[model samples]
Target: MDRRFNKHEKLKSKKLINKLFTEGQTVSAYPLRLVYLPTSLNEANTPVKTGVSVSKRYFKKAVQRIRIKRLMREAYRLNKSTYFNNLTTPHAFMILYIGNKKPTYLQMEQAMNKLFNKFINATHKATSDEKNT
Candidate 1:
């Protein structure tokens, strides 16, 4: 599976982002919350497109917020293929840093693994339920 997080995989559309907050469901792992919406994306080459967000209210500095976002992106980049390689559905994800304190890269990476695991289980269960119904 491809491990690189290229520009095509970065979520940037404003209207889609707004719809995501309104219609998306979330899977949370403490400091990291993954808000995801399954949708047909404009770019057919990418199965998932994601954006990272760190709250200014919590970080209080652009530098701090930027660092957190970087950590989040790195964590996602490493963990993406492990859980999503078989994903037939495309998704848009907003990964929000919901913690008040600064996090180490190690912490972020571990949380990201847990987050993706939880996401896979949740999506699988949802599909199974739909089939059962």
Candidate 2:
């Protein structure tokens, strides 16, 4: 409800990060790819924790990588409610910027919107299947 990206809402645990990359489901919208896994940790309070990454292979410069990551984070922060509001379980998410070139904020936002929609649908389907099983 605060709609603010806070410290506690950030994915920081090394173990969880490793698990997320290794075991999470992925959804891609061109320049943006989302890796997410349903989590039980801190389920009663925080429903989601997110991290953003930009590949060094694409952006050799740290500044460029940081800028891209910042853009992705801003987009996700602004639009996360669309994905989070419908979530019945907690999740850890990694938003990876996979473009060869830097994207405009508008472009990143659009991609993020698509990625979030895909993620929401996938999550809902998974939850429903679980319920039916």
Candidate 3:
């Protein structure tokens, strides 16, 4: 696995971000909530475009928020290949840090793994159901 979150994989479009919040489905694992929307992207080969967000309302300081975002991104970078590489279509994902306190890297990673597993099961189950019908 490449184990890198490169430029093209970063979800930076303002219009897509807005649409995701309105139309996306979520899978939450305590401190982290992943909001994902199935969408077509210009990068046809990348299966997922991802963004990480730390709420200023919870962290209050820019430094704290930045740290959280970094941690979230690191966690996602490490876990992305195992959980996301096999998807058949492109999707946009925004991972939100919903916890109030600062988190250690291990905690962030564990939560990320759980969050991704939940999302995979949800999406795969829905797809299998569609095929069955």
Please provide, for model 3 over 43-113, each residue's C-alpha lDDT reduced to its tens digit, 9 standing for 90 to 100.
87789999999888888989999998999999999899999878888999999999999999999999999
- Please give the range of 10 consecutive residues that has the lowest summed lDDT in model 1: 76-85
The sequence of per-residue lDDT tens digits that candidate 2 reaches over residues 1-133 is: 4678998899999999999999999999898889999888764778899999988897899999988888888898899876687667789999998889889999999999999989888877887898999
Please identify model 2 stretches exceeding 4 Å from their true place. Answer: none
Quote the positional error of residue 36 for candidate 1 in Å. 0.3
For residues 35-94, write the lDDT of model 1, one tens digit per residue.
999999988778998999998888898999999999999889988888888998999999
Each prediction's RMSD over C-alphas, in Å, is 0.8, 1.3, 0.9
Score each candidate by Cα lDDT: 0.93, 0.88, 0.93
Runs with alpha carbons beyond 4 Å of true place in candidate 1: none
Candidate 3 lDDT at 118 equals 97
What's model 1's overall lDDT?
0.93
Residue 51 Cα positional deviation in candidate 3, in Å, after optimal superposition: 0.5
Provide the global lDDT of candidate 2 against the true structure: 0.88
